[model samples]
Target: MGKFGIAFTIAILMVACKEDPSAKEESKQGFRMTDEERNATPQVQKQPEKNFRTFTNLADTTFIRLADFSDGFAYDLRYATENNFLKEKVYDCAECYTRVKTAKALLMANKEFEKYGVRIKFFDCYRPNSVQYKMWAIVPNPQYVANPKKGSIHNKGGAVDITLETLDGKELDMGTDFDFFGKRAYHDMTELPRKILENRKLLKETMEKHGFWSTRTEWWHYNLSGAHKDKVANFKWECE
Candidate 1:
């Protein structure tokens, strides 16, 4: 072929080889990764199950004072601590609507407890993602705060940190304070007083009955059934 014709053919080939941005994006959208690529890709590590606890509303439990139970707990209590901020606002983790439903379910399940003058005293709930990051930064331990990218079960709107309180508002002795990170929180069946042990057992049994389970470390920590256990979500509870 003549030089001009050859050059023209080469230019056409070059243009054909060049990728169109939109077409390239469409190709990416349609492309399927091979198993090797999928496995080799760095995955976002899931938040480890640090504290293993569950919750339940006792049967026949009653609330005598009818105080706003929601007020006692942090709005973000379910996911991260109050220290986590989003959009320049500190969310109340406990005040999350999803947690309120769970709490209400517990109250409903334990009508007798209400009559007997006992109610749930929440410590924390619905943690913000940013706050979880901060907790991890401080501790760098999954036992305490979840990795920000992975997130905690609380972020899923299903876990709660709580304890039982009497009708007159006295906290039950559950071995250690909520979020206590040592051996004290472990449910050592033989170590605590009989009454305190009984209280712990009672709490465990009641929560288990209503689809919650306690962590091995903290008595007050309980997770709702299969909610936050397996998934990493970006749900943030907003409180005005």
Candidate 2:
């Protein structure tokens, strides 16, 4: 073949070898969206679960790094910085660790949220018991912080402090910020603005449907059903 013909052929082959953008988008949103997502014209199709760690063959009792399994969710991880109510960096690094069951439920819930152009953005997850001690030392109040002696669901890798954010990372207002201790942060605070109420409702209803129960005091806190029975864990995640 002439040089011109060979070059043209090579260009066509390169085009065919290019990766599929839509498929990448699917990974960014985890696999499969709900029927609502499909009816709303989901941007990508659900591919087989291979690229990340799957719950298959794993013990639901095991703790796992959530971000290691999916990149779809956003993370603020306040305790890793001095930005939280503690005002001290309790965690050595920012990470979201949770039991297998909680992580699976979160993934399923996120898929539903994605259907509406939003995803779960976590402020905290699966806190080490040591950090709980640190928080208690600072606050030492039963109304605000759970007693490290009894250990909260967070110490068991079952609870997560999260909020909803758009796919592009714009946070949905829920009347207050993370660790906000007041009536305004209460789930039953109906005096909030209509938009804030709707945002909280979306978060609460979706999380509840996924087997999570919200605490009355903190709108962002959700505990997985049956997880309170798990032993409190103190292992910390490794920093990269």
Candidate 3:
């Protein structure tokens, strides 16, 4: 081998070592990347997993957060803020929880409501028994607040205060806001606009069909069937 042969071999090696962006791009389409090409590429950061929790091994009466099981429902949670009739915040944070059975019923009810292009928007769910005492301290009247000593179905984790809202999140007019104490909020009230009456009827019938019963005076309130049998719970949720 002469200097010409060695120089020609060196020239061939130099040509092979040169990078070609167009060739790399073409190979990327076929995913036939060399180790060097792969090392040079930026890695795609993986997205965070969604926090869609589950109810496996949970008891039907066990209280659990509704948002963990599904993201279908909306929440207003007025008591967590000063937006309620009590004119004060009662909860440390806004969260909705209910017994597994009640949560199952609500999931079904919301699915049915989706056919009507709406879903359940919760005002409250599974009030801590201590919160009941707080509410009673504020109202101190059986006409408005349930007796904390007896405890309402909410304390038992089988009651939810909810209203229907469009999928876009607009609330249906039920003639009155949540916590209204007058006859206007009554399920039996007939003086409301026809649209309001129809909205209440839809909410009531759907809930009742899914193992819930409504209160005569509070259209937003619904108690799961046999929920009165559960002991009132005083456990409070941790807030972040």
Clashes of each: 45, 0, 0
Please write out the lDDT profile of model 2 over residues 26-132, one tens digit for every residue. Answer: 78988857678678953797798657777888899899999779999999999989998888998999989999999999999999999999999999999889888
TM, every model: 0.57, 0.78, 0.80
- Candidate 3 local lDDT, 68-140, one digit each (tens): 9999999999999999999999999999989999998999999999999999999999999899999999999
Q: How far in Å is the alpha carbon of 190 misplaced in model 1?
A: 2.2
Model 1: how far residue 155 lies from native, Å = 0.8
Predicted structure 1, TM vs. truth: 0.57
- Go through the candidates in order and give each one's C-alpha lDDT: 0.61, 0.93, 0.93
- Displacement of residue 90 (Cα, Å) in model 3 is 0.8
Model 2 quality (TM-score): 0.78
Candidate 1: tens digits of C-alpha lDDT, residues 95-183: 54345445565555355456556666665655556656756666777766677787877666567677778866787788776666788
Residue pairs in collision within model 3: none
Model 2 stretches with alpha carbons more than 4 Å out: 1-50
lDDT, residue 145, candidate 1: 65
